[model samples]
Target: MSEEKDLFQIKSCGGRKEADEIKKLLEQNDISAEVKEREKDFVVLVPNSEDIVNEALVIITSQEVYDEFYAGE
Candidate 1:
């Protein structure tokens, strides 16, 4: 593992509930993960079409972890 301080974004989850679950899995696999909240925008086209903003969490990890758990996603 290179001494890289650079952290990479691995996955973006819609909510914290899902983010935490993923975090647990990653940690169990020996990959440290962090969850950060970000703005999420979605368009709903039912009844009244409108753009909705929501809070989303993303998974962050080191380069080595990212490479090890890429999953081709």
Candidate 2:
């Protein structure tokens, strides 16, 4: 198994669709994202390099906030 340091988790999701939603969001925004399956949860990952992790996290957080605020719409 690759060490956690190799890839940083942007979000931990309950299911494959949940993980894929944000993964697609990141790719649509031109940021690379990866999905890793854990025993209990799925996680979205980005390279550990500082070059993109911050931006990825920002997008991830922003998308999540947007979804939360507008979910009922």
Candidate 3:
């Protein structure tokens, strides 16, 4: 018998746009990701593995992207 694994939340965004952007970024880098809406926050989920999600988070939170995304804000 096969067992299904639960998705783990890697990050949370304030809205759909932000969540979709993050999802696209991860997908572009060959990592599978999804956005789940919980109340007003959008959560980024991946398979139940820490290494992949941790790497994704590092890329997403890097200084270059952070500056580009939030420079004017």
Task: Give per-model TM-scores.
Answer: 0.47, 0.81, 0.76
lDDT for model 2, please.
Answer: 0.86
RMSD of 1: 15.8
| Residue pairs with backbone overlap in model 2 | none
Model 2: residues with Cα > 4 Å off, grouped in runs: 1-5
Q: Mark the regions of model 1 whose C-alpha exceeds 4 Å error after superposition.
A: 1-5, 41-73
On lDDT, who's better, 1 or 3?
Answer: 3
Comparing 2 with 3 on lDDT, the higher-scoring candidate is 2
Highest TM-score against the true fold, candidate: 2
| Highest-lDDT candidate | 2
Clashes of each: 0, 0, 0
**Candidate 2 lDDT by residue in tens digits, 1-73:** 2666788888899999999998999899887788999999999998788877889888878877998999978
TM-score of 1: 0.47
> Per-residue CA lDDT of candidate 1, range 42-69, in tens?
1111111121111112123343367677
Tell me the tens digit of each residue's lDDT in model 3 across 1-73: 0222567787889999988988888888887888889997998887677788788878788834778889878
